[model samples]
Target: MAMAIRYERPYSHSAHWARRLAWVGLVVFLAAALSHRFGPLTTPHFLVLAGSGAALSALAVVLSGIGFIRLWRVGARGGRAAFVALLLAALPLGVAGYAAYAYFTRPMIYDVTTDPFASPPWLKVPVAHQDFLARPPVTLQDREIQATAYPELTGRRYEGALDRVLEGVRKVADEQGIVFTGEAGLENVISDLEDLAVKPDGDTGGESAITVVPVPSARPLEEGFLPRIGGPSDVLLQGEWRSLVFGFRFDVSIRLREEEETALVDMRVASRYGPHDLGLGAAFAERYLKALDAQLLGIAGN
Candidate 1:
């Protein structure tokens, strides 16, 4: 009598674990990214979730590598699962790796300005309390690094009136999806100098004496009798910009000054929260300047 044949197929547990970890990691990464983008979670929380996901993904990669070794040596039945795990882990791992590369290669600065000597002041002040990272002030060394790394990020000088240049600036900003938050020096204040006149003094009797007096008008003049010479005429615009994919916040300040027949434009961009901007501030400033140049193509000057 012949005994009944028996057969058993063994599968690699490492491959199965790798697939499960990859799936879990991918889900966590997506949740973290979506929550951060939609404002449901703070940046610090998001970072924690993202880091956890990346760590899991890295572990999955290692497990998958081990699974492949086991399959070559012991002929495991779960090779397909290992391959799928590797593919699934690639997304989060690739993103984390690229971010690491940027952090290492790029300048470690978050703020950039066209005029480093006198950067444009922010019309919309940042909130005193931030949720996560507290951005540090841009130092002289940071400015030097920015200048060396991005020499082309310079101010623009256009041969146009303040009003015209302002219009172009607004248009470019709108096209670039910058949301205006605050503004200054955009309105014209009518001079009160014309409200004063030389009136004949009644106390002078028959003498031809005259005295300068304030003429009563509907609008009250500002305090002090002397007329102000060359008041603040520079225009400043502050806005908030966000990245298309990640929605990272950035604060932007644009200053326009009228000098003779030309208007000078300067911009300052700073990350809302982070020590390093990954070279995005300079890129944003350059893009804005180029768009403004295109807007006033014929009026751009050296």
Candidate 2:
């Protein structure tokens, strides 16, 4: 009698390593995202973790490809492991790919303003030390790029009083969940309103004495410059917004200028971190403006 022949199928070692790498990558990516969202990890730290996760995922994908080729050529087990590894790696790889695409295609600007020439001043300026990336200040070239890329992001003019427009702005901001961090120039509006209310009629001009009270001012005073007794020329409202998913903070400033009977509104938005906002600043500005337009419907002008 002839002896019976026996064979044992070999498993792809590449497939097993691919699966292990995919799981590790996925875990790292999740930890990074969640820590950034809810913990104390800074932007730089988060970026490092994310990059590491992406690199591991990419390696896993390469190993999975190799495993598939081997399985196709030579009969081998662990094909299921390779397939699962590929699936597991897809999430981080897809996100990294999308981010890369956006970085190349979109304007590499973290700040955007409706009026680039006279951008709204920040009431609470960003602290330089807090930024780990140390992005350079916005330049003239950046403004030009923004203008060309986002032509529709112009300031809004309304045929309404500054106070009325400001009320609408507050309402819209509240509706959109923007938290007011600081403000300036509102006292001037109040002073102007008081002056209008207490104006003397014609031929009733007389010397009037008014007592001034000193109070702590939020507005910064320039060296050798006297503090204004009257209100500022323009009202500035500074606020912050956070993304719902990632909780990424964004600084926002809205300037309201009273031009006779009209109110001109300009807005600026900037990401709290990163050199590239991926056009999110422009998108938020546009969304806020549209919401404001809807709130102030008939009074909106060019």
lDDT of each: 0.77, 0.78
TM-score of candidate 2 to 2 decimals:
0.81
Candidate 1 residues 1-302, lDDT tens each?
Answer: 99999875678999989999999999999899898888767656777898899999999999998899889988887799999999999989998898899889889998899877667887656753455666677788888898898988888776555666777789999999899888888773222221222336464455533332211112122355433222387788899898776677789998877654456788999887778888877888899888888877643221
- Among residues 3 or more apart in sequence or in different chains, the pairs in candidate 2 whose N, CA or C atoms overlap within 3 Å are 188-231
TM-score per model over all chains = 0.80, 0.81
lDDT of 2 by residue, 153-269 (tens): 887776555676788899999998799989888864642333123334563546442322111112222357443221378899999987765567789999987755556788999
Which candidate leads in lDDT? 2
RMSD of model 1 against the true structure: 13.3
